[model samples]
Target: MLSRNQWLAVVLIGLLVVSQLPGPMVHSVSSRPAHLLSTLLTPLSQWMLSAGNRATRRPDLLQRREPGEDAVRQLRAAREEIRRLQRRIEEYERIRHRFGEQLEAFDYVHAAVTRWSGDPANPWLEINRGRRHGVAEGDVVVNYRDLVGRVVDVGPGTATVRLITHPQSRLEVRVQPDTADEPARHHLVMVDAVPRRGRFEAMVEVDADAPIEQGDIAFLHVGEHRAGRGWPEHAYGFDVGMVTRIEPDQERLPLLRKRIVIEPFRDLPRLSNVTVFVRREYERPDDN
Candidate 1:
């Protein structure tokens, strides 16, 4: 356990003691004791030297092993983060391509829906765009294939929109009857109003003798429902939905307001991207 310098001093003391011994006594001691000392000291000296070498080399040797493990872990984490970001970029590219073709037909702003109201009773969605993106409070929002909702509130960087499933949503809708070769405009009707108790559906009150069926296609905003019977009339029209479930109320047969439920053309909750028209499009002369 002695240090290197201490071991050297011990060796010097043994040599001094040997020199003081009488000549014949030294020779007699060397015959047995010297051999014993050689046997003991050889391996002990080698082991001590080996331990000292390891101690002196430990600082650099330990530095490489521990830091090597940490570096590997950090590299693996950085790779995973890069993969995640690449996936997000691919998603944005797909969304851009899908929204491009339909947007060409109209003057509109695109937005990504960032949030949703889980309540079917008061359904809504939030878009990561606002007035700064040219989206006004009353702008119409639609997926490429069909209507989604209307912008209700606007912020600097975000906007709140009311989806059609909301209890208070009342966009005018028109249906094409089953057996009618009649022009699309002739069959237009204001959707009968009802309390949105559950599920997404529009109750259309039609005549009992009318040829309206369960599979008829429907349109929204085609004709102008109400500027509240007092406000200025605005022009807005778009393809809305289709008649999926029809129930004729026997109690209202004489009244000719038999109710039918219209399901939207596409499932609204599944839509991720939508275009919001900045102003009511007055392009359709018939809508006037």
Candidate 2:
């Protein structure tokens, strides 16, 4: 009788003897076993080689790609910076076009408003420019042709501004005819601040036939009265306010007078920046 180990060894010896035999019979017997062994071992060897290559090169690939990502981030930041600068340039160009002949007469300084006072009726602003930056008391502050205020107090690098809404502020203005062809008329009037209202009112003494109405625009007049009023000559034609309401002046008789309530073209509390018209050094009388 044969044991299990003895039987396995006798079977392997018989297969080897058959593989070495001559003729087509031996190849036919060996072909299937040889094909099965080749199929299994070939894929295993290839998978191990591919995995080892990936493990060796992964860190190098990440290191090589880091600088490219950083450059992309830096490019985005630079584009944003360029856009900001272009906006500022376009703004200054628009201002120059609007106030062309006027801006040529004096040097101007741009200042940033740093603080807004709580009182709207007597609103004031603190700016980031002062005496050292050529800002001075009485210098007119404006956003284009819209009147802002005057510098009241100045330090080495800071200054305070009083807005036109203040109760003490007054300006002489002319309300333009709504239409150009409506026969040119001088609608001259004096605008005064309305206490606690943060606005101005002009009372006109006119006959019942006066042509004043709502929607008319008022502009600061440039005349002999402006010379000593701490206002620059270039600020003469700046916009002051617009006629918002028209009603009868009951205190003076409806037939003889009317009240024209004016509202500023720009809201004071929203001011963020202003241009100060600084006196030219060469034209200063004291310098001569």
Candidate 3:
């Protein structure tokens, strides 16, 4: 028997009280009303949100990309590819110019290092080339002019290389005085691996005034001792590393020789790619 306005006020008050009830009670008591209200207000809510976004100058990111934007992205990618190729070409050119005569005797197989193994003191690299790609067990792996390691195990699709830093590795190397006017006096030394240390150590007796500096390079000595080794004859003069530190050999009573440390130009553990030297069948002594 209440007026129409009084009935509306009562209903609104009831709705406000129901909204404050516990979620479970409100859900059970007003499921139909909630569904109908949501359905009626959804379009209006969406329109208000869109209008706000437009007012803020925010574009809809879910929309399809424009044709011009796609073209620009493709063009940027193509330019990057060209730059990468150019840099690779420059590297090859530098290698050819530096080791022209030495590289002519053998062919190189490119390989990507896929994994590393062994303890830190005696680590090894696994490359993605195997017998199928002419990579033999004794094949020498190198990064440009730096001697990396020797292949020890080979599978059909992969090969493992024992790095030069292995505890058992030893190499014959030579260092020359830093004098340019005088004849190059080669200081021959046998470098041995130091356990747990990723460097080579050698003892050489130098005159007090000899110009052996820290930055002097150590080159692999390829003579009668290494003549029969599995290494390619062309690898005779590759760089081993630079002289990092020199200290007096205390173990020696007279202290006549100094112990020098040689570190590779590149970090062996961080190598991503290497080249394998594959010997060709039948080589002419006079070739190149």
Candidate 4:
């Protein structure tokens, strides 16, 4: 029932469709060997994977470097210790310089206390340095600050000291008021030690209405004792201690006198190290 030309067109279209549907889904390249391509590409992929792994592990490797890690830590610690020691040395040098400045006219001999007299009222000390080290019988013994005592006896390598707390000790001292509200005034007082209860106290008499109060400082008025035969030479402005309390003079005149109790700056019982100050010798007028 169809025309010859229409039937021929339909048959041609079916042939085109059948040609497209029958071929393989993949294309093969003919320029290279297929087996060789897989072999070469496999190694390249392995190399890329290994490179990625190494990149991720770089931070950990950097931390784990050679065995010098412990050494570096120890080196830093040692440097810090050295700096600390240097600071301590510098402090010690500063103290030494200050001591040198304080002891200008007299040379110093360092010593350690060998024993204490066990008597606060008549306190004395025995030291390990003696006449061989220029520590004479009358040399002044001092702590870092001020006078502690005077050397009484000297052996070849040992010496004895009579402290300011001794009952026989006598010193000319000046009392000063530290408060700014008070007038700038200092009063001369003769001080001596006495045993009270369990401790030794230096007592001095001042005016009943003197402005001397607690916290007032006391200094040795050295020029007053220069004319005496048995007195030790001392520089002016040597600090003795502070006035701790003011009591009524019970033995002398309680109504007319006020007793000043001074606490010495030097701690007698704790004295382990001291420096001896040697006074310069001068020929007496009688000797000349």
TM-scores for all candidates? 0.52, 0.59, 0.56, 0.57
Q: How many residue-pair clashes does candidate 3 contain?
A: 0
Estimate every model's Cα lDDT from 0 to 1.
0.58, 0.65, 0.64, 0.63
List the candidate 1 regions with Cα displacement exceeding 4 Å: 1-106, 177-185, 192-199, 224-235, 254-257, 279-288
lDDT of 2 by residue, 1-288 (tens): 999999999999998988678956875655445434433443453354335434542232113323454777667645644553464355346556666666776788987666656576677766777777777778888876578888876666666788877777777777765344343654777777664444334444445556777766677775456644456666766667667778887887887777787766655545666888887765545632
> Considering only N, C-alpha and C atoms within 3 Å, which residue pairs clash in candidate 2?
none
The CA lDDT at 88 in model 4 is: 37
Across residues 100-204, which tens digit of lDDT does each residue of candidate 4 receive? Answer: 454455677888666666676667876677656667767788876556878876665667788777777777777765433344566878777675542446788
Q: Which numbered prediction scores highest in TM-score against the true structure?
A: 2
- Candidate 2 clashes: the total is 0
Name the regions of candidate 4 deviating beyond 4 angstroms: 1-105, 179-183, 197-199, 279-288
Rate residue 54 of model 4 by lDDT.
49
Clashes of each: 0, 0, 0, 0
**Candidate 1 clashing pairs, residues 3+ apart or interchain:** none
Please write out the lDDT profile of model 1 over residues 1-288, one tens digit for every residue: 999999999999999999999987886655445334433544454355445444542232112223344777767655644653464345335444544443343467787665556577777766767655666666678887467777876765567788776667665765764222333423655664343433357876777667677666666543433445111122233455667677657665745656777766554544556787764254323432
lDDT by residue (tens digit), candidate 3, 1-288: 999999999999998988789987776655546434444544454355435434643221112222355777768655644653464355446556666666775679988666565366768877777767777768788988778889986765677788877777777776753233223555777777664444334445554345567756677775566653355555656667777678766777335657677766666655667899976635423334
Model 2 local distance difference test score: 0.65
Global fold similarity of model 2 (TM-score): 0.59
Candidate 1's TM-score reads 0.52
